[model samples]
Target: MKAFVVTLVALAVLGPQIARAEGGFKVEPSMLTDWKTVYGQVEAKDSIPARARLGGTLVELSVTEGDLVEAGQELGRVVDAKIAFQINAIDAQIAALESQMANAERELTRGEELKSRGVITTQQLDALRTQAEVVSQQLEAQRASRQVTEQQATEGAVLAPVAGRVLEVPVAKGAVVMAGESIATIAGGGFFLRLSVPERFAGTMKEGDAISIDTAAGEISGKLAKIYPLIEGGRVNADVEVADLNSEFVGARVLVKLPLAARDAILVPAEMVKTHSGLDFVIVATAQGPMERAVVPGPMTKVNGQPMMEILSGLTGGEEVLAHEH
Candidate 1:
């Protein structure tokens, strides 16, 4: 009778534990939604070098590093004493040519009068007319030379080609510079986020596509400005011009999120999904027991601007999933 009672007690104790293990669900329901993919990098819209068109010693630098300058504003000047002196000399030559042309004109008039009265031969008149024409041509040539000299003098004054902050001033006052040498560097316009999309994703993106950039400062919206045709390192380069990044620093690192075609998906916290043996899965609580289901993950997305992962398959809405722990 005692043995029978012990047997009954063991059965009573084991049955509930087995039923609890099989029938009770341990996890809570996790809402699922679509997600987007993102990458991070430092980027800028454009960087242009300010070069000197004429070689000379830098005589004056009106702009300092980090100074904002407007397009066509003069930044500095090169020492152009030689060009000025040459211009002055050309003016003197032009004056001399003008005097010679006047004298030649007077001689031609005299010859014309003498020929009309038959005092001078037609040949002599013709020669005087030719001399006047030659002097006129010389004056024209001198004027042309003077114009060239003036243009060079103007070019000696360095000007900013675009409106932006000056990033660097490589040349200082009294520093000799050569033609085509960069005198300063400028970060034109405002900041932009540059992204390199994998070649596989190149066709999915286009100019004017909307993108979101997250920086240390804040999040900003931007549009794809350009997509390069050539592929390098299995990646395609693209530029994202930030329309609202007026206050952000140029070349600052930012996270860029790209949206794909819309589709229904189950969303979960990224950390909750784990990979094991090259397989991705999420632990879910079922009516029978805790279960690990295989899943395909899509790009991460934002929910109310919060980061979330898209579960492509395996889990359904209102299902309980264990929170992922580090």
Candidate 2:
């Protein structure tokens, strides 16, 4: 414990020295491209909203934002109070009507027996028969109305129509919602990177053109999926589809490298490049000592299964660089 405490104190005292100690890098020339990098955003290919087919107050919301859902998944419950009450009322009316029909049938049987024994008149039997028929028809109508109400009640459960990640749930629990109102916004798993390119490069860009996406998971390749017909503010918008990525990039910003034309560049080992205040620099060896020179670094690439960066400007070929080891 004593040694540990001493180490902590030493680290606190040497914090500034440790931060300032950075290694230097060397530079070399290689064939590279002057590719133009345009900022792009990864978006869902088709973001569809899951809507409520029946109107009611939203209740028991189960799906949350960013939750993955499958087809036929229950997102929440909708309580249509009026429909429930109507069903109950219809049920009660059906019960009463059924009881009345039973009594009318018994009375019609008695009237038939009396008429056969000549104990009742034919007009009385005819009246009893008409009453029984009318009661049966009324019962059927009530049952049909009840079925409609029950169907409405069954539709109260909100269901997801597609398999995807839920992007947003706009309505809150206990909020009154109308039929066809969107309950959740879902991105249907298919993702694409959206690139806004300058209109000057429109003729150069074509469908299926290859591009690279710079992300936290390093760089990956994608292709142009579409080109829009309209150009806004001197920029043409297009979508690039990348495989093997989930919805993680669905609204994330990524650096997109579009091939412009090829040019000669100074290639250096990736580790040799140092950064300060977002600017890249390399060390050059002179008779006096090692000197730091600012250099604009381009896209990172592999020259022979080894990572390298292209230097866009700063040094011409064959400059002796100082490679400092940390």
Candidate 3:
């Protein structure tokens, strides 16, 4: 009789545990999503080098590093004394040509009158006409040369090539700069995130894929801007253009989550799984009783914005796991 009572107490003790596993808790198959994570940072895709078109003294510099500017805005000016002198020389040449043309015109008229009176031959009249044409050609040439010089003078004023924040000002006001040298650098066309991925995903990743970037402010949505063809150091690089990132500065670091390819993964509610001794465990109801198995967790994701954990192994979508809070 004491043995029977002891057995009854043991059954009562096991009943609750079995009942909890069977009815008190729920079990369901895990869900799956196709996504991956990659690390990267914010970068500027279009950095323009604001350069000097003509060599001269840089004057009236108005932008510094980290200053915002717009397209065609004047960043600074250059003064070339030689350009002004060239213009002055062209004006003098034009003045001389005008005087010569006037003289030639008068001579042509005199020659024509003489020929009408038979005082000079037609050959002489033709020579005077030729001199007038030559003077006209010299005047036209001088005007063309002056136009070119004037264009060079106007180009002395450095203008912003695009609308963006200025990154650097390499030249100082009143400093001498050479032609085609960068006076300032501007980050244009907005900011983008540059990501590096393992070379294995280079073939699957493509432009226009969705990407998410995490900033201090919050998470931002973005898309793949470009995929580089060349692989470097066992990885491939890509550019990501995010929405509302125009305000973001260049070289700002951000955590990026990008999808490489579709994958069939099992995900469970984050609360349903528990970690013990460095391994994940989930309770499963078996014919004998409740059982626990080790699970491999891959990544944390969201289903309809609900938090979940991805299971890499130890459970497929076909198995039902008991939901319990540890």
Q: Which candidate is the best by TM-score?
A: 3
| Candidate 3 residue runs with Cα over 4 Å from true position | 1-37, 201-208, 260-267, 272-300, 309-326
TM-score of 1: 0.65
lDDT of 2 by residue, 31-92 (tens): 45446799888688678888887898887799888898998899998888899679889999
TM-scores for all candidates: the values are: 0.65, 0.66, 0.76
- Model 3 — which ten-residue stretch has the worst lDDT? 1-10
In candidate 2, list every pair of residues with a backbone clash.
none
Instruction: Flag clash pairs in model 3.
Output: none
Q: At residue 84, what lDDT does model 1 achieve? A: 83
Provide the overall lDDT of each model, using Cα atoms, as 2-decimal numbers: 0.70, 0.76, 0.76
Task: For residues 1-326, write the lDDT of model 1, one tens digit per residue.
Answer: 00000000112112111011232223222333212455645444457888898989998889878788888888888766688889889999999999999999999999999999999999999999999999999999999999998898889888888888888898888998988888888777666666777788777776887777776668777787888899999988788777766433555555787754444445665666799999998777667865788889877855444455667677655566664435
lDDT of 3 by residue, 1-326 (tens): 00000000112112111112334233234323345677777677689999998899997799999998999999999888998889989999999999999999999999999999999999999999999999999899999999999999999989999998899997788899999999899988867778888988788777887777777778888888899888899999899887777454677666787665554556665776898799889876678866888999877865446566767888765455666643
Error of 1 at 154 (Å): 1.8
Indicate whether candidate 1 or candidate 3 has the larger lDDT: 3
